[model samples]
Target chain A: MTAGATDKAGISWLPGRQAGLALLLAPALVYYFVVLFLPQLEIATASLMAADGRFPVDTNFRRFVTDPFFLSILWRTVRLSVISTLLAVIVAYPIAIYLSQPWRRWRAVVAFAVITPIMISAVARSYGWVIILGPAGLLNQAITGLHLGTDPQHLLYTETGLVIALTHLHLPFMVLPITAALQQIDPSILRASRILGAGSMRTFWRVTLPLTLPGITAGATIVFCLNGSSFVTPALIGGARIPMMSFLIYQQGLDVRDWNFASAVAIVLLLSTSTIVIAHLIWSGRRQRRAAGAA
Target chain B: MSLPLTSQVFLEVEDLALSYGKSAFGLAGASFSARKGEVIALLGPSGCGKTTLLNLIAGFLVPDHGSIRVAGRSLRGVPPHRRDMAMVFQNYALFPHLSVEKNVAFGLEAHQVPRQEREPRIADALAMVGLSDSRTRYPRQLSGGQQQRVALARAMVVRPSILLLDEPLSNLDTLLRKSMREEIRQILDRTGITAVLVTHDQEEALVVADRILLMSNGKIEQIGTPEEIYERPRTEFGARFMAVENIMAGSVCSGDTAGTTVNTAIGQFKCTPCDVVTGANIKIAVRPERMHIVAATSGSQSYENRVTGRVVRSTYHGTYRRLLIAVHGMELIVHAPVSSDDSEYSGDVQLTWRPADTHVLLQ
Candidate 1:
């Protein structure tokens, strides 16, 4: 008799839960449908149109695949994205580790300094980078002062300058995630490792690094995706000499009025970012499953 | 593996003091010594600095003053890995990422012990804890009690000069705690490794410790064998901590060589003098089990200390009946074992005990 009552009691809260979930998620669902899904559907339909504006045609995609200009632009986009992500990871890991230290009481200040670029408008920050990387800017001044370059070095409007600027712009997004992951590690585990006969460096490699891999993966994926789609930094700094995919898309749609081709390139960029993110999620999920099985 | 008889102390913690922030004395001026094969339990209440002392011994926390020495060599500057002592934390700090065998072998690997010897040592330690069948299991796969045994085996596999346990059973439930306490005791006793355990559970300490150091407020209250501590507590804290209840204020009324009669609210009682002169203020302590309850209307018997009182309340505990008697404006608790028919008299009961049942407190 009590079992029957308990079964009914357990099932009684389903309606309330449904109501609560709808109340909480309605706004986000509406916004996603209107802003993200509608635009994505429109882009998918427009990517199939030809230059003559016929429906269900593959000319836009054919032109993109055959043209060496678009192919080189896509390749440069991926290369720059990979390089920037690597640079961010290498430069930010140490800073994140230092920020995650228990005795680092000024961690908030350091974190604010690392993320300050994100608070400024991306255009303004990229303009600032343009000033620093230009021939008459900070780099050339330092080089001339050290007598390494004559008069001024043409450091600006180059791939190197673009990568340096992108790395600086996306460094905080990388560090924030990694630092959060590093902070979740219990201090007692490290102490226990030391007591179990591991030195500090060994403990860091064996315990701390493995536990923070998820954070590293998240930060890398974010930085890569953002740097891959970046427009303002490369367009303003590299000028006409360098043609990143986003800058090319802007030129195709706005300047040349080739909306179909621009939409196709946009879809390709979205697919690439999605593919990388999905692969990462699957890899981490499998790793988690293996850890659970081992445990 | 035999050393000389006078090879000096195995581990000594001297005058150590520590604090977190401005909180005074997590541990203060604490000192103790352990020989090669003894178990000393640092028994105390929570926040009384027992875990801090263990952390200091494990080299996890550096003391603000004094020194820690192992084998007469000062270890004040030595790091935790170099201290060569294994610690079993309260939460059973087993590496969740490693299997039980791997956890046991970690110390050996860190010390660069030969790969051939490592497997055998790990296997032997696992078997010692009766966990050979579960050697491949991770800590998350095992029950809490089993995980603790794995932690024990891991600590023992290292064969350090000293082993430290910081409230290792506090996390377990009551029945598991009792069984695991026995398992821990057997393991420590079989190895005969010098060990120090910190626990707030007095019962756990009494059951497992060869010698119990009772502490309170950053100082050692008393230190003795469990039996000595229970029967002859030196301080009020020790007396109360050991659960010797039944305190009453009394002054000497009649004096003799063997015993003295003291006038108290519960009437005149004969007690052994606890270093007190006649006619001095004294506190008398008697365990609840020592007092017997009789009907207040019963025929007078020749009991040395008998007080007539009404039974205010009675509780039927399974083993015995605990009665609260109102005598001379104070409650006297008397425990009556259920077996004896003479112990069944309930309301308005006359409590009685002989001179030796009462332990007189001078201070």
Candidate 2:
């Protein structure tokens, strides 16, 4: 008889092993069902009902779609989010590359600097932006001190100022994922490309960028979502002059006490973000497939 | 830029040296050359500077002192991509995202071989490596051996001036390593491409290289044909690295044109004539397999060197029986054909070897 043949199966209470796996997953399953899905189900059903309990529950939806003010707010929110998301991705790529090199002595310091803003409360951080983006703030002072301008830069309560703040807030989210992807790439792969007669620039374009696309996709999705849903930065920096979807949802639900209209607006925001995110996922997924298939 | 097709000297490295810190040196004054289409193996154990030499030639590293030349032109400031040399990495380093076809086409595209000229060359390279059917498969989808073939194809497709293989077969299973070493040698021979291979395995160097550069302690121990390096290693380091079993310290007692005689702690021995002065301390090596355990009565016969010793232990190795015999003050290993009966090995046995088999190692 062989040695292994005489040994009994392990873990007596978990005979099949499948049951043990299910038991291990019980906590997360219960939490998601109780704390996430059930409340979302109620809000989804309630979003279709009118406030007065009247027939033709499409009352809030029609009012929201026909209003110019609400539509403009929606447009401004999407515009600012997209512009900021793009800005964050553009600025984060180089920083991600730098952070991924383990041999750099200052890597830890740079990483801490990148993620420091995220640790502070968003309200406090938005207030900091408010100070700098004021009419005669540090930015304008620097602009004049450089002897480049005496012009009145309307950064305070402007769309550009809000975008700058959002990009700063979400920059870490963008850098971390791309850094992970860059670290995953084998260094020899880069060396191989060089040995094959491609210079550094061509190697980056042909090998580094394509291999790190998944990281870029993940970062973009996260930054876009965070920017779209954020209320504090916009409310403080943009103020009443530049209203956004989040502020509108807040004003409608609490101050005006129009719960149905608020719910309808929330639903619209959720749907818009989901549609864009899904489109992006599909595009990236198909691109990955094409990369594999073309070989 | 013409190489004269008659295969002139293609690569030359003169006194190459590199160091990491004050106490640690990576390579020290290594110098060698390869004729056009000649395959040279840089053979050494780990930390012995073989890979450093390969990198210096490939331009991934620049020597702290010395010059590397291709076709007699200095490569002091040339970049790797501009050197027209391609490398096959040990891990295969196939482009993970690209298919087999695209991986093979990468070099052609980088060199801009022209779209019309690319397809035929890619096909030829793939066929050369026997991977034409797996063109559409991604690197992740293929086995390790297949990926290695793709790597070979990718390097070959570039038609590089020099092919650098950095321990290319070190990652393969033993069975595959045995097969791939022979295949790589055949490919190099068939194409007549100038190549340099770095390996820690001596057998690999013997099988795949026209010449072997043995290294030790960040310096070269010897460079010669495989048989020369194995059968007549000039240094003790080379002998040990080549798995020489019997290395005994001795003093040269006398010298003549016929042979040099050395006296050791156990007894006196005769070896091939050397240029060393008589009465100098030296070391001599003999292979275990070269020694013979003759019958006890044959001790009286005419043999160049003869000794009788008591058997300490005997091991059965299927085809051969290894007798570990205790001489006067030292032990010697002798390999003899397995006798009909294993019981007789416990008695004292007489050993014999020719004078030519005794090798004097130079310091």
Candidate 3:
């Protein structure tokens, strides 16, 4: 204690020791508050504000609560997100399963091919979809060429077209998570299951699917969130008539200059997306806990 | 038409040969048969193709040039699950996700055994392995011995045509391995199921197997009861594998038919010409435990062979003193029993044995 006191005696004049720690972390703290937490808080406050640009004394949540137009917009966003997420999951699962197999050389090649669409610009990818979705597009031409249809199909600028675009855009998000999850499973577990009298199909159903649920949940959440906020791909491929939430938010804030209304819509969309992500995470967590408990 | 229990051949593998590729040979001309209610152990060192032989019988592998027939039906293209056989792996290989009960019940479910029948079978199998108390425990929760018991329960629960155990006890510690070996033997006997086991440990094979199949360099060196493989080894490789000492290279010096006397460097020794011919290059094999140290110069009895050697080193290993004797530039390991009454031959001991103890192996 005497030696420590003697050493501290000379260094006692040192200033900003506590301040230095805060100074070191100030940038990250400020960035987190300003970029993330503060924006969310501001949006929440702005959503509760009246048309006068001041937060309402009463609950102006009534605007979003009472308007059927806003309710329909919300429904459309959720409906599109659900459909697109479902499609993405359905298409991505088998591809992820194939990629997760033991063929490393071919896995690399096939994985690259599956994800090659992601390498192209999203705009360019949507345009390629346009070429396929157009009446004179390659898909219709192929259908006519094959004599599978009597006429060029009416495939473009609809909810179906938007769903198709959203699915294509978010397919990688689904496959990547599922693939990662599937890869973590022990190969020996499968072999053991097979030896223990399980047929291949039964083993997959009883073991593989349940073990990879976390990944499926993660992939679905990503695809859903992306589909919910989707603007460019839908606008380019689905046309302005579809009017997803992102397109409406953009129209109100930038094109129509209705900042308060746009902020309210943005806040609602953000809350919906966060709620879905959190709910999925919670469900997956509960399932994993139960599995662990059983094991 | 089923043969009587004692006369029935449960599984037969005739001339089984396996090779992975064009040049690499796995097992060559391996042939053996197991009878009902008997446990046959395949005893060999690593890479001696013991596991390959077990795999062949278990239907996990197909032989390139022979056949496996269980219950007189050729399992040429039968998948492992379809072969009506179960195996206990060296690693245990119990399903990690399944509880002990479920692991045992897996085969029942696979065979589509009615749910009402499966529960009791699972319970009985688990109880047989003394794992009833831990039936609900996962594999990771059990000890190594417990896991092995679970694996045994899983294999036995199936009540398959035959059981294949691929070095199942090799993963256990010495004391546990000994106890589990007895436990498994008792279980298999109680079930009256024909079983095939592969192990590299001589003691384990001797203790457990009704008959031991000795393999060497991808071939069946010898196949016989433990006593035959040990006391009456037919090949030099077989004798060496069983801890038999004093393998000597020599030529037959005597042609008369009572026996052939080989003029070996250790000294000229009389050997029973059981398999070797006179005037032929041969190797003589003898067990170290069979050799006795006698008062060579003072003995009233006349022995067939006697060797004078200096004990280079003597190590007392609790039950016996393993002596390394240098006799005419060759080292012979002799296992001499420890006794307080017997005079200890520490250095420069005279070793002698009867001619019948010597088995001649033709090179």
Best by TM-score: 2
Model 3 TM-score, all chains together: 0.86
Compare candidates 2 and 3 on DockQ and give the better one.
Answer: 2
Candidate 3 chain A: 10-residue stretch with minimal lDDT: A53-62
Q: What's the lDDT for residue A185 in model 3? A: 83
Query: Candidate 1 chain A: minimum summed lDDT over ten consecutive residues — where?
Result: A286-295
lDDT of 3 by residue, B235-312 (tens): 888888898877999887775557778878778898876545567788888788777776535564546788878888
By lDDT, the best candidate is 2
User: In candidate 2, residue A107 scores what lDDT?
Assistant: 94
CAPRI verdict on model 1?
Answer: medium
- Per residue, candidate 1 scores C-alpha lDDT tens digits across B295-334 of 4454645467888888788788999888788887998888
Model 3, residue B250: C-alpha shift (Å):
1.5
Task: Assess the local accuracy of residue B139 in candidate 2 as a C-alpha lDDT between 0 and 100.
Answer: 89
Tens digits of per-residue lDDT, candidate 2, B58-94, equal 8888889999989999999999999999999999998
Clashing pairs in 2: none
Clashes of 1: 0
Say which docking band candidate 2 falls in: medium
Q: What 10-residue stretch in candidate 3 chain B is worst by lDDT? A: B294-303
* Model 2, position A245: C-alpha lDDT score: 89
Model 3: runs farther than 4 Å from truth?
A: A1-34, A56-61, A103-105, A180-188, A229-231, B1-6, B22-25, B254-260, B295-303, B340-345
Which residue runs of candidate 1 sit more than 4 Å off their true CA positions?
Answer: A1-30, A54-69, A94-103, A138-155, B1-8, B135-137, B250-282, B294-308, B340-345, B352-363
